[model samples]
Target: MPTLLKKGLALMLCWFVSSDLYALVILQYHHIDTETPFSTSTSPDRFTEHLALIEASGARVVRLEDAITRVAKLETENEIGPGPDAPAGNEAFQVAITFDDAFISIFRTVFPLLKARGWPFTIFVAPDLVETSAQYLTWDHLREMQRAGATIANHSLGHEHLLRLKGRQTDDDWMKRVSDNTREAERQLTMQLGGNRPLLYALPYGEYQPLIIERLHEMGYTIFGQQSGATSRSYETPKVHPRFPMGGPYSALESFRTKLSSRPLPIPHRLLDPLLGHAETRPSLSLHLPQSLTRTHRINCFGPSGALTIEPVGEGQYLIQTPAMLPTGRSRYNCTLKASDGRYYWYSQMWMRKLANNTWWEEP
Candidate 1:
């Protein structure tokens, strides 16, 4: 009887943990060179080691497009069976590998390594950079990589930040910019490769306003962000997908290991919602907990000021009744749940005002 009771407890804990497990990692890379200011560039040897580590860990390397498709299928309002390529079991984890900026080294070095391992990756390219022999990927090299099983996606024409430019010349300026860039890239790629035009785009520098995102969507491009988080069925948003940037000075193999092994960290409340203002009105969030822990579990909603204790309403769901209305300015907030089983989960998001106009705008 004692052994039976222990097994029951273990099963209960597993259920509790699995109930909230929703995350998928997406790793992003740019150049893999060895130059100053580009120290984040992975040497060919280090790159090989990285691939070996991923292989040994038994992690699946998916393309960015595949990742998007999986998340979209999972986010469907009503779906019975698993979408294409999803694991038979719902608990399986997935990781996607993506490269941005269409670096020459990616074609020469990364492509060969991935081909040998039979791995899939997505490369976001700036069409203008192709065949220039000017510090960017050439069309010939890109075609070779694509033939080797890599998917090439759009990253705009000049790789410029699409946000932060506004006013008089904005509308005409941005429409031309977006159209010319996207069309030229699409035309060149189609003429050369005879494949479907890439419908996905990565925001340069991960900076974009709501207007910019809307414009990209209007242009038939699914937007991707450089935010640090994990993708999942629950957290599916076309305009703000998560990506882990892998080309920073502080990013080492150990760091990569930690990223691969650990789950996505929750966004801190302070960073999401600042204490100085009221900015939570735009996107109000609530936590719904399972009924298993009616008496012992509590939900804590944290902000820049401090923790806001939320009282349980029903089952495991908690209601946060703010003392003051959320401000109109930009803000962010984080949520944490301390369960009776001694485990917790964290999440955060930023809330900001939408743009006034719907017209296209450029980053000048």
Candidate 2:
């Protein structure tokens, strides 16, 4: 073989050998404009800075589905997008860019930036909002995006809270209702975009029950939740992934760089405690040190208020306790430890509780 060909083969071998170790850090955005709600908006200027920083970080920007396949171990790389001519992707962490809600700013601003770099992205569209509102993207805009190598996937028909149920509805009744909406939203994408888009769903308001996940899994949909983590092969949920929210002040480049480079904390499948509880309920999160981890002295677990209590039980087990009862609504117990590589291994456990009257609380 020629010298270049020989180098190519060697790189290919390296990719295959280390493929299992790859991690995906998916960045989730809702609106890329300054005018929308700040809680869900990143300024267009900040988004441009984000793109520059992403390029500087040296992380591979991949399509969401392709990243999922690699990190979830769903398919060999050959089955996804890389070819022999493609750079061997084993060394750098992969990042996927996703915009929820199909906002017009994404079409006006984000699409061109991504397209110029030849990077692929996924847009989770809520069909009911599109074309009906001035803020949201239209069907024609979606089709244009699809033609320009973007994925327009399902965010549900109306973007309603799938977990919220009517007073008289059973869980079975709720599932049927939400599932029908999901299916119809997908149908709209197929009809409008004229392609078989992947079955990817983002939970609205970042709320989910175990039953909701079970049903969506049965429906053959891969889920992305509004949470924080570096999704890895060791993720507890194979089909459901967590995404780092990139909106409001959190879109600042400093926080962005930290999360962009963070590693996934090792967690097992099927964590049964507090991922919610009753209002004002204190929840305990128990976990063990990763097998490769040694010297647990630098470990830190943070809660909504401040630093949490981490008690080391016998063996490698430890229990993290919150300092106070979490306020009603959604919260995350984020634990981080500095690894030998100087990057933090991050794990976020979501907790949610309804108001005293059983009404939902708005995110503050």
> Backbone clashes in each candidate structure, one number apiece?
5, 0
Provide TM-scores for the models. 0.65, 0.86
* Candidate number of the best lDDT: 2
The global C-alpha lDDT for each of the candidates, from Candidate 1 onward, is: 0.59, 0.75
Candidate 2 residue lDDT tens string, 338-358: 755556677788888677766
After the best TM-score superposition of candidate 1, give how far the Cα of residue 220 lies from its true spot, in angstroms. 3.5
Q: Which clashing pairs does model 2 show?
A: none
Q: Give a tens-digit lDDT track for model 1, residues 118-189.
A: 888888887777766656788778787888778888777777645434445767687667666667767766
Pairs of residues at least 3 apart in sequence or in different chains that clash in candidate 1? 131-138, 272-332, 273-332, 278-327, 279-327
